[model samples]
Target chain A: MSNDIIDGILEAIRLLFTFDRELWGIIEVSFRVSLTSTFLAALVALPIGSFIGLREFRGKKTLSNLINTFMGFPPVVMGLIIYLLLSRSGPLGSLGLLYSTSAMIFAQFFLAVPIITGTAKAAIESVDPTLKETILSLGASERQLWWELIKDSKKSIIAGFLVAFGQAISEVGAVMIVGGNIRWETRTFTTSIVLNTRMGEFGMAIALGVLLISIAFIVNYGLTRLQARGG
Target chain B: MNLLKVSNLYKEYYKEDKSSINVLSGINFSINKGECFVIIGPNGSGKTTLLRILGLLEPPTKGQILYYNEDLCNISRYKKVQYRRKFSFVRQKPIVRNTSVFNNIAYGLRVRGMKWEEYINDVNDIIKLVDLKGLEKKNARSLSGGEMQRVAIAMNFVFSPDLYLLDEVSANLDPMNVKLLDDFITKIKQDKEKTIIMSTHDPLEAIKFGDRIAVLNNGQITQLGTPNEIFTAPKDEFTALFVGYENILSGTAEMDLKSGLTIIKINNLTIVASEQVEGEVKVCIRPESIGISKNPPSNVSYRNNFKGNIEDIRDLGNTCHLIINCQSERFLATITKLSLNNLELAINSEIFINFKATDVKIL
Candidate 1:
């Protein structure tokens, strides 16, 4: 068993060096879907999060509780919801998004939005209340206050964006049901790992696993460094 | 018209469960233009609440705040913004933006649509005014606490707001910073026709800077007058204690109608006050004005002098409070700790306490 594990590791390293076109296709698809979904989610979440953070209103606690609950949503449950929504007989069937890259993007967007919104709200809320009061007392308009909050919390907002991106890129279940693990198109690194392992291609599976981990490490390291330096 | 008149202002803070706490109850006062009014009070006396309401940062629950003959309670939101910019609030915990010192001071002007050149001249003058030269480009957060407070004042005062509302602006400041602020405020008062209203717990600061003094206690203004008036004649027991009237000796007053004087005899100790206050009087003597000596001074004409033994010696750094036990009375004399050490006074040593008759106020 030890020899088998050593041989598998050696083969994975060799495959990593070889840079197979099929593996590159999986990586490209993952990047394309994850980037699109993260951008779209951040675009929608940041303003809404800041709006929610700066205002006190009725039902605010309920809204915050619901958003927090969504943060811990089960990946498989999210997959099931997307599958039901995009299937042939589903409500969104007429759009023909089922088993497509766009369907995978939509699933990833759903997975990422709650994380982005929750973190962004916490970041904006963490800024000093006196800073807000000082700005208002200095005659800042409503629009100016919004922009000032975003400026003041730029580092934490970027941290929120990176967190959402990480969650999107690493998510498996939602992407699986929606992408269908198509060989050349929808096969992300995680989806390819499952597909290749089931087909008894252990070498490719382990190679994709290593690559997935390396990507996650690089992204997290970059973000954390940015955060520490107050970018 | 008074620059600001508050009639029965009240503020109630409600908790998340909707139960209310009354922070300010029916606070009322008025300040005329260019008057430096000081509010002296203890902690939690609603001084900050009154300042907030006057600055238009917090709305009063039930009353009218009229500024310049305009009822601020009914002002429209847009007009409120315009009016708020005309009043500046500088807090003790200086709230500066996490930006360069120059930017922090220029923020008000920048918000008011001033050009960069206009900001340049104005910021320079303010930095000069606050004596914060060579720190124009430094991050405000990196500055010392005193420097941060100076920048906050410069920021607020740069716009020449008609009213400068300082909320304990000298609290916890070092002596050097306190002196700097005192000089800066004095200069502001000298140059600008701005009305300055500040709250301070330090009686010395109030006595030094205030043109008019208001004593606030338990959310109510107990007395408002000149510093001398408040010091010479505090309305109530609390005000008297707050204004450094530490010695409150109760005794029976024997009025000498022929000489227009009242003599109080407590135990075997007799102290004469110049005023003809009738029976059942309490004589208040300020500790600073009382003298302490190991031996009695030569034939001084001051009518209030007591020979006693030192009961206790409290060395409070700058000053020492010596509790003296007279034959039938007790008195406190606040002398410098240096004087106590130089005199080599001990707790059980005999001493003489002397003050002029004019310094003793019989209430």
Candidate 2:
């Protein structure tokens, strides 16, 4: 068993060094789906989060609590919901996006939106109250006030974005259910790892696992550097 | 003409449970153009709230705030923004941005759409004015408390607003910073076109900085007058105590037919006051106004003199506060440290305490 593990490791390293085409394609698809979803999620979440964080309204607490609840939503349950929505007999069946990259992007976007919103809201809320007062006292216009507030909390907002990207990149159940893990078109690093492992392709499975972890590491490192620069 | 007039101003803060707290009530004051109006009050006395309302940062629950003849509350949003640019407020605790001191000080000018090249000299001059010249490029957040306050003042001063509302801006500063701030205020006061309305709990600050001082206590202006009037003759007991009048003696006063002075009898001592009054009266005399001499000098102009033994001597840095027990009536007297040493005063030592009848204010 130890020899098998050692040989599998060696084979994985060889495959990685050789830049296996099929494996890199899966990785590329994973990044494409995750990056697109993260971008789409930020577009919706940043403003919503800022509004929720900065403004006081009648139902703000209820809305904040609802977002917090959504942040903890189960991935598999979200996948099931997306699967039902994209199924042939479902309401959006005419769009024919089922088992497509767009469907996978949609699934991941759903997973990431709440994460980004919750984090960004928390980030903006943590800003010093006196900073707001000081900015207002300085005769900052409405637009200038919002811009300064966002800039003041930029570090946390960037961290929130990184968190959303991390969630999207690592998410498996939602994308697998929506994308159907088609070989070259829709297959991702996580789903392909599962497939290789199931098919006794241990070398390829280990190689993809290492690649996934490396990607996560690189992304987190980059985010930490950005946060440090902001600090 | 009055630069800002606030009439019947009231502010109420409502809690989440629907309970409300009246922070300021019936607050009325009009600041004249180019006059330094200082509001003196203790903590939670609505000094900050009043200033915030005057700064146009918050609206009064009920009142009219008029700039010249125009009511501020009735103005449109664009007009309000335009009017807000006319004044600058420096809060009690200096708020610094997480950026360079230069950027922090330049924020007001930048927000007003002034280009860097146009306002850079002005910003640099303000930096020097606040004595933060060398640290302009340093991070504002990394500075010491005094340095941050200088930055806060420079930030406000860079705009050179027509009206300045400062809320205890020097409350937390060191002596050097306080002096620097006082100098800045004096320099600004020289500009006859500028109007300043500041608040402080310090009696010395009020006396030094105010053209007219407003004593605020419990959300109301207790007394509004020149600093000399407030300090020398506070209208009420609260104002007297707040202005550092340590000896607040209550007694029954009656007009002395022969002397033409009011004689107030308290405990075992008969005190003479300038005001001719009858019935119950509260008289206050400042500790510094009382004379402490080892020997009773003859033919002094002071109307009230008493023989007392030193009850307690408190060494207060540059001065000593001697508690004189004159025939069971205790009186506080502040004397110079040199005098304290020269007299070699100790507990139970007999001393002569004298104060003028005019110094005794009957409230």
RMSD to the true structure for each prediction, in A, is 11.5, 11.3
Interface DockQ of each model: 0.33, 0.46
Q: For residues B70-141, what per-residue lDDT tens digits would candidate 1 score against the true structure?
A: 999888767888887888888878777878999999988888888998789988987997789999999998
Residues A1-231 of candidate 2: C-alpha lDDT, one tens digit per residue: 787678779989999999989978988899999999999999999888887887778998899899999987887788889889889999887889999999999988988899899988898788898788788778887667777888888888888888888888887888889899999999998888888878878898899898889878987998879877834
The positional error of residue B69 in candidate 1, measured at the CA in angstroms, is 5.0
Query: How well does each candidate superpose onto the true structure, as a TM-score?
Result: 0.77, 0.77
Mark the regions of model 1 whose C-alpha exceeds 4 Å error after superposition: A1-7, A88-91, B14-19, B69-80, B191-193, B245-363
**Residue range B296-350, candidate 2, lDDT tens digits:** 8699999999999998887769987787888877788889899999988899999
User: Against the unseen true structure, what C-alpha lDDT does each candidate score?
Assistant: 0.83, 0.86
Query: What TM-score would chain A of each candidate receive against the reference chain A?
Result: 0.95, 0.95
